[model samples]
Target: MEHEEEEDRLSNLPKIILHNILSRLPKKDGARTSVLSKAWEETWYTFPILYFSDGLFVGTFPQPWEGFLRKRKNFIDYVKRTLLRFYDNGLAIKQFKLSVNNFELHYMSKDVDHWLKLASECGVELLELCLPDGPDQDEEGRGECYVLPNGVIEVKSLTELVLMGGIRVDTAFMNHSIKFFSLKVLSLWAVLSRDEHAIEHLISCCPLIEHITLKCCSVLIPNVATNFLLESDTSGVMKSLNMHGLLKLKTVDVQGIQEVYIDAPCLEKFCYCPGDFDAPFKIDFDRCQNLKYLDLLSLKSSIITDKWFLELFSKFPFLESLKLNNCRMFERINISSVQLKVLELSNCSNLKEVNIDAPNLLSCVFYGGGGSEPIISFLRSSSQLEVDLQIPIDYLDLCNLRESLQNIKPQNVLSSLSLFIFQPTEDALNPLVFQVSSPPPSIKHLHLRSVPKNEILFSSVVNIILSSCCPATISLSFNPFFCTKAFIEFLYETLMERKEDGCFCGSGDTRCWWHGLKDVKVTSSMKIDENVDFKTMLELLGFGEEISFTLEV
Candidate 1:
């Protein structure tokens, strides 16, 4: 009866369904499940997925982690048993994953050999070996290496393979007879040999490759950096995907992976970052039907335009978020995201135009331009947006901005606006007059950076602000440029008098009293030696009662 029931269960499942179910099981667990019933007995043996995790056995017998790792024969025995059991079961594997760690380096090779032998015989499709990510810290890229066993020579079904961290991958290990490999992602910090010919042999052999990632990888005879074709490389090819399966490519993420060929239909998320700027890759995403996210940072060079960016965005049917940074010469971005939530633009010095139509955008930052005019104009179209308009004092243009708030559909639903204005120059006098004319009524937090610097008399300017708007917090950046000995002496003298009168600005007996402003911060660049000025600035702001370190970012 038990024997008949097992046979019935095995016969009921279709081959593909049986393959998927068995794929989820860990190699050890899958093999052991054969004892459950007679149907599973042979099923585990012929299962198509073989997963080997060295971490699993390490965790099974846990002790306090010491820097010292012992060579335990028992540990080796445990892993050997698992590998032999899988080999004995004789399952044809669809995917073989081997993860090696520091603790198992001594004995993992033995167990690894057994696992590969079984996988090769059964035709493993996806072979992956992950070593610890130690390559990042070492300049020489020195770390442990794995040697494949002699019995593991033939794997006719291998497809995707990844070697990361300290995995010592040489030419011979890659010369397997596997074709339909759709992807190969490698993060190589160190190469045992920079043999470009060997690398080429490996890639050329796998014509089915579509996606490849080599973070900080240094290979390719002519250097991958030299592989950029002005329009498209006539030799442009998917190294990992079959030509028959070229359009089936999806995504490629690389480091030092300079240029990539994107002639795929199903390609989705493409993240390519070259740490050095002089060398950059150009991708054509026109045919990619499902492309969603494009994160290109640490990209060294590329001529950028709205048309090129728009062409990239058009590929994704449901893309919502996009971030661009560290890219120079790419100016004028007109954004129109149907479902974008946040748009952040920073440090793109050449970024000039921002024409956005993202109605769903809830937050915006004009961190690039310090003058208040462009950002305020940008937000004028936004109904109620939480904004950080940090405009430096000299060129602030809030002329139409102060009154535009009334036009928002629901007046002032937006929470807060942080404004930074400097008034060190005589030309700053005109904008100072403009500020007092229409002080923001909903101004929640007012940050005054470098307002009282170089012994500059802020007496009149202080009175106008005190009578106009009430601020929650006032911050000061006593910059190094104006932090002189003569400036400090006058500032110290004025601060003592101001504090005695219970106000930062001279006239404070009105509703807009400086006394009401709760937090007052005084800070400078860490390199600046402002020990006397910083101490006295805090005293003047009434923060001497409770010292506070403030930095204007």
Candidate 2:
């Protein structure tokens, strides 16, 4: 009689709380709980996320992995019991993950279709079906796309979907009656484009999609990105997308794509790059109002001129961060991003000068592809309203920077600087001439690539920086010639002593910008700089590296 009363109390526990507990346990173990009695029998089915690995089930089965999985689901009565209980719980599933590798091909796609259909019927929101290996039997010379039935694609709530390596994947589902699918993220891999209209048909049906990522899928120029439109009359929101390795793509018809408008009011970031520079393409996001971040590998403007830059910025009113890399024909860059903060220009072949005018600018770096002369000229000519400038030491101005040091117009703000000093020229010409022109008011990081000549030996160069910028912490680039133990020790002690003198050690309220350089980062390419490690610099900077600092949102 006491036992009966205890069972009654267990049965009366809140269903929602019990469901959470069972969902957290291994599916197989959770199934065993159903055997506790009839009341527990119906609890397993309520578990929303079912993680069943075929390798896991093989341990309980009498036969090997393939034979066990090929058999009926009920053959392993425990797993069957778990699923039965899971189904009886009447809980809508949010995510379903099947962790199985080398899935036995002895089982046909029909078998997979059955289980996935069960998940579809249960309304799983995220279906991550991953088959890392392709089928062992090589029938088709090329990979084949899936020929899915109409019933499987009908899951209305599924927003995130990943399909990689199983059958060939052709997105014919694009032309299907796609309904109730407000899918936000879609990742497709190894899919070919034999059909002429495959890409266009697939994207047209996605009524509400924000992001698209394509990787490892090699194809011809059949599906061009320029053909898609963001029409002024249309009401659609697609904000973020990543397209990589569409190798042969030759052109993008921006005029046609302009008609298919963006519906995402909050769209901020986009990454799209034509694999080749000469690959015919056109990019026009004129209608996209709220775009903030753009990572364009190659902007194939017919001619890159000053007028073209102004027109591009005119389209993107709120553009902040712009990255231009590997563009050979791009000679002059005139950027007028009103809200721009971080500008990273790397490996622009013909890039001669940069004209940047932004009030709230924080950081700027130019990794000139062996073209330091043109960059230095721009640094000297640009407006010096006390902005933080990081240049290859060959380019800095010594005298002018030192004069403006103490009472910077934006008095409280610290204009942090980073220098990459090239080996001094063979003549009396010191690349340090640039340093004399623009003395860094509050230099934080100094990365020296090649040591200056004996005339401007390492110590004298260090003295010049200490006199000009007064950095709180410093990082010297590691090189075979200058990377000796004795030199590092002397440098460390000198920086520590100077830091104690209260030069760059503190600049009140300037923490907003220079804080990222709290200690110092001495990035090396190949060899080890065993002499002065980053930890040694952190010790001098007075901040323990172990404590983590969190940024307030």
Candidate 3:
């Protein structure tokens, strides 16, 4: 019997549906669909959004300098032709993104200006340009950069503008009469401006901006004392960002800024990372009562004290997530937030005690460094709370590790524990010893990562970890420089070969945790290999960066 022919329902779908499908696909894949049929070719032309990158046009293999230049030229021509097609057809471009790397700004400045003019004429709503500095960029970053044209700023239809890398906002920007009146989002990364007023003018023009990100953006101030200075003293970097009445702003992320004054009442998230740690840092959120997420990094102990945290929680009552990194806190601080769900603390060395009373918290992650361990106490937390602790283990200091682990309250559920083992100094020939006073807490998974110099050190480290923690599953990740084959063999021999006789506690104690082990399985990329010898498996699977061993006790 003959089967009925399948209908081409995909191609026959509505244009809007086809456009949606194409939007979900990568730019190259979406453009390739035009070759499928004439109907698709028409749909591709009217797609309304164009994204082009010089990197996408380059081949995977390294090409000669001449070939590279030819490919770059072709990419530029292709972008121009694509934009021209939309302009000629009078179709509104919803979004236009162009990313150029390794291209000299002077060589392509005119072409970039032309492209912007075309996009403006096409009524582009969202415009993104990522033009990284050329190889000739000086250390001071006052080198040649693509000066944003006045035409782009005058585009009243623009709703979102993202300019990254070696772009400059000159003094002309401040004098421009037209502004981005309809813009809702503005992101400037590594963007250079003539002065602080230029940046302030650019932002103040965007009255409807809801989100703003300024990362590593600088202010270039030409040195007047040319005889005394060798080069332009580009030291006038952006020190402060003050947003007075951005009522629509919801998110603000400013890095490399010493001070930030935000008065956005509707702001929901704010992240700030100071440019200089030694410089005096100041931040004031006047009326941001609707904030939900706050992230601060590299703050001094004096800036973030117990009183500061009290004022923070009192000001932003709706904060849900708080992340503090490399910040020095007071000796003891209380984080009493009822709405907090996620809390992350990293390298807060000065914190001796932390009391959290967030009953709605769902997860808390702590990353430790060489500083003294902070005793974290949770007065009230959700029953479903999961705590993740990443602690570094100095081979010479086993007692410190034990003390750090013991500092964690027994009531807190440690879902995952990651131990970063630091190699001992070469002169330290003494064998390290670890004593387990009581049974280790039940951890769902234990991740051990280290770059041991030899197999003997790796074996000793593994034994010490197993003795300290009774984890259901243990994951091992090694550096590629080490011989993974030897490590795997040692692990297999220790966990499987000597399972019945060996005790990880070093002392001959039969009551060890692994004595009741029923089965041991190896998992690679989530696939379990049962009853397999490590030597043979290593030969079959070759060397991988990570390997997991599951213990059935």
Residue-level lDDT of model 1, residues 146-218, one tens digit each, is 5444333244455666555444344565655643343343223333222434343454455555665556544
Backbone clash count for every predicted candidate, in the order shown: 18, 41, 0
Candidate with top lDDT is: 3
The C-alpha stretches of model 2 lying farther than 4 A from their native spots are: 1-85, 97-112, 131-150, 164-167, 216-268, 276-278, 299-304, 337-342, 362-365, 370-441, 445-469, 474-553
lDDT of 3 by residue, 345-377 (tens): 999877788888889999999998766678888
- Please list the residue runs of candidate 3 whose C-alpha ends up more than 4 Å from where it truly belongs after superposition: 1-7, 56-69, 134-143, 175-177, 226-235, 429-431, 451-453, 481-485, 498-501, 504-510, 526-546
Candidate 3 residue 480 Cα shift, in angstroms, is 1.1
Sliding window of 10 residues with minimal summed lDDT for model 3: 1-10
Residue 469 error, candidate 2, Å = 5.1
Which should have the higher lDDT, number 2 or number 3?
3
- Descending-TM-score candidate ranking: 3, 2, 1
TM-score of 1: 0.48
lDDT of each: 0.48, 0.49, 0.78
Ranking by lDDT: 3, 2, 1
lDDT of candidate 3 vs native? 0.78
Candidate 1 wrongly placed segments (more than 4 Å) = 1-72, 91-97, 103-111, 119-127, 132-144, 147-160, 168-177, 181-212, 220-245, 277-290, 300-321, 329-333, 336-353, 359-553
